[model samples]
Target: MEHKIQPLLNYISKYIVLSKKDEAVLMSKLIYRKYLKGQYIAQQGDVCKYECFVISGCTKMFFADEEGQEHIVMFSIEDWWTADMGSFITQTPADYNVQCIENTELVLFSYDVIEELYTEIPQLERFFRKIIEKAFVASQKRIVRSFSLSAKDRYLYFRNQYPKIEQRIPQYMIASYLGITKEFLSKIKGQLIIDQ
Candidate 1:
């Protein structure tokens, strides 16, 4: 059981020094969960209380408009974290829904438990802050791509940034993330195939 947590501890260790005892304590508060494909891990209007780290498979965060069309915010793969930052930090309802795109495994740490851990293991505070900085950079990049790049350029950028995502997610979902219609994406893909 503790061994199952080593990967998560190893992930944190890159940013902070966790003593054996601290690792044990931190692992004790972590909860492992599995979700089948198409399962909702968190929904719009629900408060996101858990900060989840993906262990395997893929998940996406999206929000629906008044027409009920989903616009994908981002995708989370193995070793990546997923949460509605606004909801998680503010303890308010989320504007996005997070769902598994495939059978997924994740480790969830509650906000309260993480706060306690930060207090007990001060080094974790800096570690988590770095995580926030990475999230900010990603968000900034997404915004810049959306505003300054064409859909094809954005698609290519996304593919370059997450080289493995094309193999993992459905084309329709990727199209949604790129803010382009499925047909357009198909055309782009066809062109790529020709170029290759």
Candidate 2:
């Protein structure tokens, strides 16, 4: 698992350099876990216990509507982080559900463990701030695109941003993320093919 965790160390290094001591402390608290496809990592009403970094595989963060429709907010794949920020920070029930899109391996930090890490390694605070900033920025961009872009354009943006993820996620899931119907997504794809 150390080898698997090396990627996380590498990722964090890109943001803030960690000393051997700091690295050891951070790694010591991380929990390695795996979930098979169709497993739920976090449910709508359960407090999120872990802040997970994807070592490999994919997951979706979605919410159920009054009609029981699932609207995907985002998908996290290899090297990405997935957690309900509100739930994790506030220690409250999550509004979204995070489910594995495929068999997934993750390195997780519990809420308590992360707090300790922050105290032990102050630079880790900066690293996490950057992570949250990126997530927040991406979220804002997604919100803007939703109102301004056509469904076809949104699909194209999604494809360009997540080419690998596009292949793994089902059409219906992708449609939900783009706020379109599955049938409509099919039409958009067919039209794209014609244009190409």
Error of 1 at 189 (Å): 1.4
Tens-digit per-residue lDDT, 56-81, candidate 2? 99999999988999999999998899
Which portions of model 1 miss their true places by more than 4 Å? none
lDDT of each: 0.89, 0.93
Model 1 lDDT, full chain set: 0.89
The digit string of per-residue lDDT tens for model 1 on 95-145 reads: 999999999989998889889988888888898999999999989988987
lDDT of 1 at 188: 92
Top-lDDT structure, candidate number: 2
- Tell me the spans in candidate 2 whose CA falls farther than 4 Å from its real position: none
The per-residue C-alpha lDDT of model 1 at residue 174 equals 95
Q: What is the TM-score of each candidate against the true structure?
A: 0.96, 0.98
- Model 1 weakest lDDT span, ten residues long: 1-10
Clashing pairs in model 2, backbone N/Cα/C closer than 3 A: none
